[model samples]
Target chain A: MEWFIAKIFAKYNYWISIILMMIGFYGIVAKDNLIKKIIGLNIFQTAIFLYFISLGAVKAGTAPIVDAEIIRKGYVYANPLPHVLILTAIVVSVATTAVALSLVIRMHQEYGTIEESEIIEKSRDKGMTWT
Target chain B: MIVSIDLILLFFVVVIAIAAITLRDLLSAVILLGAYSFLMALIWVELQSVDVGFTEAAVGAGATTAFLVATISRTVRWEKK
Candidate 1:
């Protein structure tokens, strides 16, 4: 029972992250505005980042800082690989957001509105084939 | 991170995300996204990823907000009903 409390119950980050991910997914799928959809995508990505970072935590472990004393003490270092990967992923996410927002800007300039449904309707009205 | 702090941060992040999606003004939503990114950075630092938190704070909150503002300025602010 104590082990359960110490292990499973201590790892609560995963469940909340799942909920957050769903909210982002909902935004991407259901929102009418392109910006809102993009916001949702950001939210979803953040949630994934949270989950991945959480997975890197070690029980009774310290941060992955290399110190001679700590090494002699044999302290367990939390996995640093996920942290590095997520760092790169965050940058990529920002780059992706920039590109996606620029596309929205173009869509707005052409269609005069950023709503997904309206853009589709306007494109069809203009006789442009949008697959 | 303290469990209580972690819970509070997570709760606020979730609330802000919901607000960001539901808000009508694109500018306000963009601002909320900046706030969201800042909170996410704090969460990362708490998770022992200080480097990731720094990138998120600088790029996610900073550059992303700038790009969003530019896009909004060049396009529109309010979502049409």
Candidate 2:
């Protein structure tokens, strides 16, 4: 029991990320409004970013920026690779969100509503068949 | 000490997330989401990923919020019951 407690305490960050992931997943799956779904998607992406960054953390580490004295002491520095990759991911996320929102706007123009069920109903009313 | 603070921030993030989804007003939800992104950026900084945090603050909180608000303005601001 003590060992289990020790392990859990040491790895609490992972648990927090998992909880966040579940919340985002629920938002994406259960929400009916298009904007809410998009918000959920963003939350999901943020959770993944958090998980990746937590993975890169080193105990007693400083930021990855270089300094001679730090090198001389053999101090650990946080991994730069995940930071670089997540930077790219953030850019991609922004672009994706822009495109998605634009598409939502277009859909709203067509269907006259942003609710998923309403869109379906409107399309069906217009004699549009869903496969 | 830092771990405790991170945990508390994580709890707040979850609460804000729930509020963002459950709120009735679309505008409120969008604003809450922007707040969520800002908090997430802070968490990244706490985790020692300053670059990611900076990018998140700009892209997640700033650009994303602007994009969402603009879209909302062009479209409807309330979800149908």
Candidate 3:
């Protein structure tokens, strides 16, 4: 039973990551509100982060730090490269979110509504008609 | 090692993602999205990506939530639905 449970858990983690990514994608594509779109974008980006971090896991691996005792025993440790890459990715995601939010705010001020359909309608009425 | 905890975490992530996107209320969606991020962070920690987990907790669960709430305050809470 224990082995079965472990196998199930390991398999389910990957599935969960995939489902989160898809849901985030759906939100980004289907949501009408500008802010909700941003939320979805965040979700999508976070799902990728989760995926990458999960990929870095190594069972029974120690921290990447080198200790004298572990060196003597010649034991391997988990790689820290992925962790460093993810730190950079997180910063990039935050910067992107900030810029997107700023644009949304500007759009709201100009159109007075953040709904994508309403914005399109208003633009059409104004003879912009770029939809 | 029983992996049921990981499965439960995955389940929570899925449920929160669904709630985040399907809700008519924008605030609710934002909150659920934050919850989703937090669960993802927990998964990262379980996977032994402490640095990534820290960043996810900080930016995903923290700043993103703040930004969404602030944006919602400046706009309507729900759509026509």
Candidate 4:
């Protein structure tokens, strides 16, 4: 029991992120609504961001801002590389969400309903096969 | 401790995530998703990624939510069961 607890404490951040990732995966796979799916995608993306940020964490570390005093003492800083990468990721995520919402809007305009099953049914009536 | 706080925030994030998906009302779900994004921004800041956190707060909490709400207004409000 002690070993198990120790392991959990040592790596609980990863465990939590894994749980979140699984939840988002379930949402993307099981949910029928497109909006829910988009939200799920966001959750998944955030979880990934969480995991990346956690990977960059350091014990007794400060932010990556530079200073002469800190340089003299060899102060450790949190990884700034992940921060930069995740900035790009955030922009991409927003762009993707916008495009997805616009697509959803277009689908609603075409079909008059946003439900996946209803859209599939309507498409079938129009002699379109599931692709 | 920071670890405990992180765990607690993670718990809330998970709960909000589940609620965002399971909620019957689409508007409520979108709002909840925005809240989730804000909480995530907090976590990123706590992790010392303030730049990422700022972007998340701006894009995730602000732009994404607005886009979702606009889409909701243009589309159906309630999810069909």
Candidate 5:
């Protein structure tokens, strides 16, 4: 394939993450349903997480377990810093999803629909103008 | 070898993510998110972050999917558009 011969990417991870991030961003910005927006948000977050973890990868590196054997063998451990931050980020993403879902629940209860456009129209009809 | 496992996994992840965003059935998208998260965990492991992968499996794939399913059941199964 001309695509492969093109050598379009040497580091595939970053490009993959960027493509995923754009998909998520499009979902968040263009989708009509609130649930889809949340899904998009999750994808975007995961893209960022992947980018960070991939940045920390080193050739022939092992997991950052810090064992004696690894030290004696002089193994280069994958950078642990990004992993720790991503751990926190994943937990936070879950929390954000929970909160957003709960809010969507309440929005459906009040407006009888989860479509963002319909919700906005309803609010306008009800004279609940944003200030 | 022309392709590595990383490229394969990343390609699959991108395909699933696109499907998830484009699908009209909300429930199907939620399920696709679970798959995406699982593949993401595998990639993390492949990248030599075992602990991060473990957390992604437990939290992203497991708990997030459960929460989304519950919320979807309470709300709607289909998107307006």
Candidate 6:
């Protein structure tokens, strides 16, 4: 039963991460709203984070902290580098989200709506082409 | 080893993602996207990356969702088909 649980946990983790990523990408591509696109972007980035964190796991490993006693006993420790990188990634994600939301707000004020299709339609009508 | 639980979780994640994309309501899509993130975080936790899992929970499930919802509230909530 324990072995079954472990396998289930590991496989589930991988599949969940992948599905979230694909969905996020689909949202970004298929959604017409700028805000919704940003949300999808966040979801995509988060799936990557989950994948990396999962890769860092070590079975039966303890925290990376150097406990004097544990060191003397020579116990295995989990990798800490991924954790550190993830912290940085988290900060970057927050900053990106902020910038994206701000851009959405600006788009709303200028275009009067946040729908990508509507904005494109209006711009096309204006004959002001911008790639 | 029964990998069934993970398969179930994976199935749910896929369903949520599909729902998020297929829904006409932008608000519902955003909410489902948030649910997707939360599920991803749980996967991270199961993999034993406590720190990464915590970060996902905070930034993905919390901050990102809030940002999306706030932006939606300030703009239109539906896309015309």
Pairs with steric clashes in candidate 6: A3-B1, A4-B1, A4-B2, A8-B3, A12-B6
TM-scores for candidates 1 onward, in order = 0.92, 0.96, 0.88, 0.95, 0.94, 0.79
For lDDT, candidate 2 versus 3, the one ahead is 2
Two-chain complex of model 1, DockQ on C-alpha atoms against the true structure: 0.73
For model 2, the superposed segments whose C-alpha errors exceed 4 Å read none
lDDT of 6 by residue, B1-81 (tens): 124554666677778867776777888988887787788667656555667767777887788778888888887788677
Against the unseen true structure, what C-alpha lDDT does each candidate score? Answer: 0.89, 0.89, 0.79, 0.89, 0.93, 0.76
lDDT of 3 at A12: 57
Clashing pairs for model 4 are: none
Chain A TM-score values, per prediction: 0.89, 0.95, 0.86, 0.93, 0.91, 0.85
TM-score of chain A of 6: 0.85
Weakest 10 consecutive residues of candidate 5 chain B by summed lDDT = B1-10
Superposed model 3: Cα runs more than 4 Å off: A1-11, A73-75
lDDT per residue for candidate 2 within A90-123, as digits (tens), equals: 9999999999999999998898889988888888
The i-RMS of every model, in angstroms, reads 1.3, 1.3, 1.8, 1.2, 1.7, 2.7
Best by lDDT: 5
Candidate 6 regions with alpha-carbon error over 4 angstroms? A1-19, A69-75, B1-8
Q: Model 2, B1-81: lDDT tens per residue?
A: 278779888889989988998887899999999999999988888888899998899889999999999999999898878
lDDT by residue (tens digit), candidate 1, B1-65: 56788899989998998899889999999999999999999988887778888899999999999
Worst 10 residues of 6 chain A by lDDT: A8-17
State the C-alpha RMSD over the true interface residues for candidate 5, after superposing those residues: 1.7
Clashing pairs for predicted structure model 1, backbone only: none
lDDT of 1 at B17: 87
Report the TM-score for the A-chain of model 1. 0.89
User: TM-score of predicted model 6?
Assistant: 0.79
Can you list each candidate's DockQ? 0.73, 0.76, 0.56, 0.78, 0.72, 0.45
